[model samples]
Target: MMRDEAPIHAGKSGLRQILRVATTADHRVLDALGTKFDLASRSGYAAFLSAHASLIPALENLLDKGPVPPRWPQRRRAGALAEDLAALGRTLPEPADVPDLASPAQRIGALYVLEGSRLGGAILLRHVTTAQPDAPVAFLDHRSGERCWATFVEWLDGLDCGSDEQRAAIEGARLTFAAFAAQFRAWLATIA
Candidate 1:
């Protein structure tokens, strides 16, 4: 059965179901962010990276402070964002302070936003390549492509969290997305 048609089995695998349910709202935030920046220019791309740099590391640090699943890879893109910013001759912006994520489930939920971004990065990379072939795009490059996303989903599906933990994860994901939206808006205001 197709993913949308598949029945959600209750147990260790409901995180994926939660994420699937959240995808629509997630896409809306992503779309609004996309429209907020001009991907065709160097400054615009730098602005995008700056906006992301302000959040990615903060979320990653939050995840690091807790116990992450051993099988889950700790993929970080903030360093790449900094490198790209330097390569583009743009100064790195100070990282923003994200709210504390105190639980593993909440950390995982926030990570869902960061990890899922790789899927969209594939498309963004193509746009950057076409628009600024010489611009550093490491931040947008996910060498493993869909494999990374599949791995994350597989791990998420195997999580054994209870109802409260599940709710925390969902709340964490929502808050992370909202934080990104807020940062994007703030960045746009600065540039405007």
Candidate 2:
């Protein structure tokens, strides 16, 4: 199906479909952020981690404060990012403003961005390993042998979100993506 088109199946799965559709533009932003960092040198990797340090903590804080289902696994990268930063002789950047995810649906959508990034972590881990073989990449390393995105989707599919909730979720995902992209770009500007 087209990126803009909703999935054929409706209901809870449709929330996932709509989120995917609505965040297509945000995906471009994320892709650009990924490319902006060279990732081939120590400084490049440090810059990348510094960019994440600015965003991850705030996002995790929002998720921590928001209403999430008790059974859902909390995926906080702030600690991992800090560990990687310290290992690389880098420090965490000041936290950025997190996207407002007030409702459960919105929190779920924001969580989707965090969980979904793991799908790309495997590839990033490879790059980090090649660039800095011994550098601590614990955040990316955690995805090893884990079906994180699949598990998240299964949990997402089980949630009972109506149309309004689905829209809120989509908005939350878009906002989270946008916030991360904006923070990364701003951080780059400061370093450059």
Candidate 3:
């Protein structure tokens, strides 16, 4: 699902595919940093969650301010994020400022990044469960039965996206990725 290949040249203009292609570089960079930590260890897990704390909560809060996007409340993870951090006796870091996501297209684009992250969450959850059975993975262990990703994708594919809409969507996603990368780097420095 996290294809890093060059953008598709086929007649594919679906929002899903466009977002995937646009965010590939961002994904790769984040993945590199993501792999740098050992999730099984408490310290490493705390570091990982702290990096997330800098972005997800603030993004979710901004999303909450407007008309809720599809499954918005269900997808909010700031509370679950809090639970996981508290389980480790750590507090969620004060949220970093998110870019202003004022447009509906922008919100959907941000949602694309947010929902896409769930896929990665499943993989991380596996690593945690197998190696550190007691690790509190409340953030990762979200939406046990709901088809969050599928529904989001279906809603995304339903949008009638023109070139301008596509550009905005891609911009929103890129900004989010940048925010995350910046936060991750800052957290990494503190721990180093």
RMSD of each: 4.8, 3.4, 4.3
Clashes of each: 0, 0, 0
How large an RMSD does model 2 have? 3.4
TM-score of 1: 0.86
What is the descending lDDT order? 3, 2, 1
Pairs of residues at least 3 apart in sequence or in different chains that clash in candidate 1: none
Report how far off residue 164 is in candidate 3 (Å). 0.7
* Candidate with best lDDT: 3
TM-score of 3: 0.89
Model 3: CA > 4 A from native:
1-13, 65-69
Model 1 bad stretches (over 4 Å): 1-13, 69-74
TM-score of each: 0.86, 0.87, 0.89
Alpha carbon lDDT of each predicted model:
0.76, 0.76, 0.82
Ranking by TM-score: 3, 2, 1
Model 1 per-residue lDDT tens digits across residues 1-192 = 655344434454368777657556875876677677888887778788888988887677778775464444447677787888899898778889895678777788887887888887888888889988898987898454447777777777787776677777777777788888888887877667
* lDDT for each residue of candidate 3 in 80-137, tens digit (9 for 90 to 100): 9899999999998988889788887787778888889899999999999999998999
Model 1 misses residue 121 by how many Å? 0.6
| Candidate 2 similarity to native, TM-score | 0.87
